[model samples]
Target: MALKPATNPDVEAATIELTIDGRAITAKDGVSLYDVVSGTGKIVPAMCYHYTFDPFGSCGMCLVMVEGKKAPVRSCTAKATAGMVVRTEGDDLFQARKKAVEKHLSVHPLDCPVCDADGHCELQDMAFLHQVTNLANAKQKLIPEDTRSLVLDFNMNRCIACGECINICKDVLMIDALQFAKKGGFTQVVAKGDQPLACEFCGDCLAVCPVGAITNKYSKYRYKPWQLKKTTTTCNYCGDGCQMIVETKDREVVRVTSPLSWKNKWGDRSETAKG
Candidate 1:
């Protein structure tokens, strides 16, 4: 039997071609340059560029050089266009990303050794990629940690204001539990009504957090990222059967996470399982 033609019109459309660092790449139109570049094995460093939520471009770590533009553009927000010329890596781009990383480290405490996200943290990976040996020499700002939440720990000192947690909590989850308060240097994430966090203990915010600012309070200091052996499985708690990544260390299951992907809408664990 002859197979029926693909029903999706978008699948048959011509792909957009773009150049990155002198290498040509083809991608579907309307997708961000960050997606295209990352799909081609050139991962752009970003703190607030989660695949589940809209790209906020709050962090400048994914800056890239675009033809005809004097200043570097954020790859996460820059759309892929036919014949577009992009430079993902160069001296200028490197310097810009380096400065961005340095600024984030200025107020961040050096708690990676003890932090739960030690090996898998994005900031730590970026620092290593850029060979950033020195933390910002500026006076570190000390903010009191908030531990009122029963499931997650909030450390203001470690937050870079990337807005991933706030965006996910408010926009994606439709839960107005978290928001950015204050201005300039005083701005920080706070629960709505200034009360103890009261919302779905989904832990989605903790999953998207780039830094250790928000972490699992129950599993805090239990095990390092490298110590765990990840096993992908399906949750059988309900009929939805959501996919889960179980982390085990020394034969003990330490933590569970719903792996995020383009196929997973809003990174909703329950919904993903249903699909």
Candidate 2:
């Protein structure tokens, strides 16, 4: 069987040849350079990127060395060009990406012990993978948590300001319920007008948050990622057949989550608003 194209199947895009890590590869032209690199089975850590929406280069962890560029460029926002030579690995690239992760960690709170997204967090995984051991100047945000939402809680202290939630909400789902606001001397994601979250409560924001900034109110501090078993099934609420993950603890239903998450980042979720 032929492998499916990495880009959208609806439109026809020109094929382009690119070299990654000294290996030649062909990918869809005009697509994200990160997507092309990821298609080759190489995992480049990226916190602010998801296949569901356009690239939002907030995290800056997806840096790659291009032939002509003097410095490593963010691959997620860079478009794939023909006959381009790219390098995905090096001590310089690793240190560059590590510095990007350190910036987010500098202002992030150390609440992983009781955080709901502790085990399943992208930030946690990236920190461990990148060997982020010492942070002599790690400052805490200390912002108060926002629990006004009916189903979700916003903890600004733990937020990395990745904008994954805001991008997914605005670009893919079209809800545009969340936005970035300067509050308490920090940039934070908040509901529109800086008020309580009032939207479809689809939980896509919670799913895309790289850190423990946004969490489910229903299952907060109740279960860890290891304790829950996830079951992917069809959503019965609508006819669109949007897939969802049902979390269960000891055979008891805990929470219903959509597949549009940060870890399992693939596919187009534009039609998920109807779900």
Candidate 3:
């Protein structure tokens, strides 16, 4: 199913006009340039960006050329302004994005074929879209995978440190179970306390991960993204009638997921209790 972009309440209050890639567009005053350009035909590759979360501008993939600026700016964090000129595509922008992807690939594991997120991985898609064949640096440090969680698997080597997992767990889920520890290239997401995992088994972290770094333990090796057929339907168990995307393979249901907005309100409640 094609998901519509969520309306930004700030944009509804006021509107601003801007030019993107030579085409003029009017958007809400405070909305990010990335969100405005995303609605248009322009393609801006953003790995760390999620519409539901506040823009962190962690990944440099959404870099764009703004008029009167020497260096490209991150569209995900840049606010749209009246009379501002933004270039979404160009040879310079392409090279910049390609370089960013190459840098990410340097530390990332080249285990796409064997990874559970193989077919639907954002990093993999960006690498292919930008035609990133070789990394400027090829040295990859080994980081031990975390399998202490019985419901999920954590592979530190495959993480890009986008902060999505940590942010969603902290801000949205209200479960400060995960945190970013260390710095520089050695940074990693770790569960709080001495235990490997110290939060409820809501599996919300797995929903926000863009790579194979976090995945459901039960579905890890079972089915690829393309192998499953998705069906959107209303949840009969919930009074809220939350919509869910049910994934099935060969008539067998593999997994069920709902929008983050829906999950935020009633996610912690049991299925039977919500009915």
Candidate 4:
């Protein structure tokens, strides 16, 4: 089953004119400025913003220069308005976004060699995209990994605190299993009440996590992303026939993923709950 948007299909949203990077464009009124920019085939690096939920502008990577604004605004949270002049790219914007990535990398531990999400981490992609190399006062979060959950491991050291996992769990799955809590003098994601994660084990959190903060215990250290050959197939587990991508490594099944993944973040909760 494919998830749909939450808007009414019968009624179309009103359109408004906006200028992005000096190019005039039309977008749905009241929609996210990020969405409008993305519709124009422009990519914006954002960690906490996903299409499945309301924008939580924790990562400042999606900063855009809006006319009359002295500082860059977060495009994900800012709504598109009529006659809005937006600049999505520039040296100043790049530097601002780079600083945001550096803030996360400064506190992050250098564990990509052993991390399961190394090859498929968005943080890695963003860092490389921004050419992040060195930091002035680099400090590492030496918090112990939380392996209490049977299905996943919570490594606070690698976490950027994007809140994507928590938002997806609450907004998309409606499970409300995860939350942000202050632990070890740093804000980290934990299960509600700081207890062992005991939820539906839907693995939505695993899929939406932008970094290796949350990793699958089953596939941990089993294979890198490049070793897996993906085969798109339907799930036979139930009659819902939810589409899934089964990854294999050398004839052995590695991990099974659904359409609901970090890459495919747009979906309606009503449609996804049915799956």
Best candidate per lDDT, number?
Answer: 2
* Ranked candidates, highest TM-score first: 2, 4, 3, 1
List CA RMSD, all candidates: 6.5, 4.8, 6.9, 4.1
Judged by lDDT against the true structure, how good is candidate 4? 0.81
* TM-scores, one per candidate: 0.82, 0.91, 0.84, 0.91
Better of 1 and 2 by TM-score: 2
Over the stretch 189-254, how does candidate 1's per-residue lDDT look in tens digits?
A: 888866679888767777777787887777889888778898999878778666788889888888
lDDT of 2 at 104: 84
Q: Which is better, 1 or 3, measured by TM-score?
A: 3
**Each model's lDDT:** 0.74, 0.82, 0.74, 0.81
lDDT of 3 by residue, 1-275 (tens): 22223225432346678888778777777667777787675668887776555778887999999999999999888877789898888899999999888888888889888898887788888889989887757667587778898777888889888988887777666778888887445888888753688577666577667777987777778888789998889878658675777889998998775455212421221111110
Query: Against the hidden true structure, what lDDT does model 1 obtain?
Result: 0.74
Overall local distance difference test of candidate 3: 0.74
lDDT of 2 by residue, 1-275 (tens): 12122334356677778899898887767777887787777888888877777777888899999999999999888888889999999999999988987888988877898998888888888888889988889998788889999888999998887788997788777899999999878898999999999999988888888787888988888988889999999888777778899999987999988777776774433321110
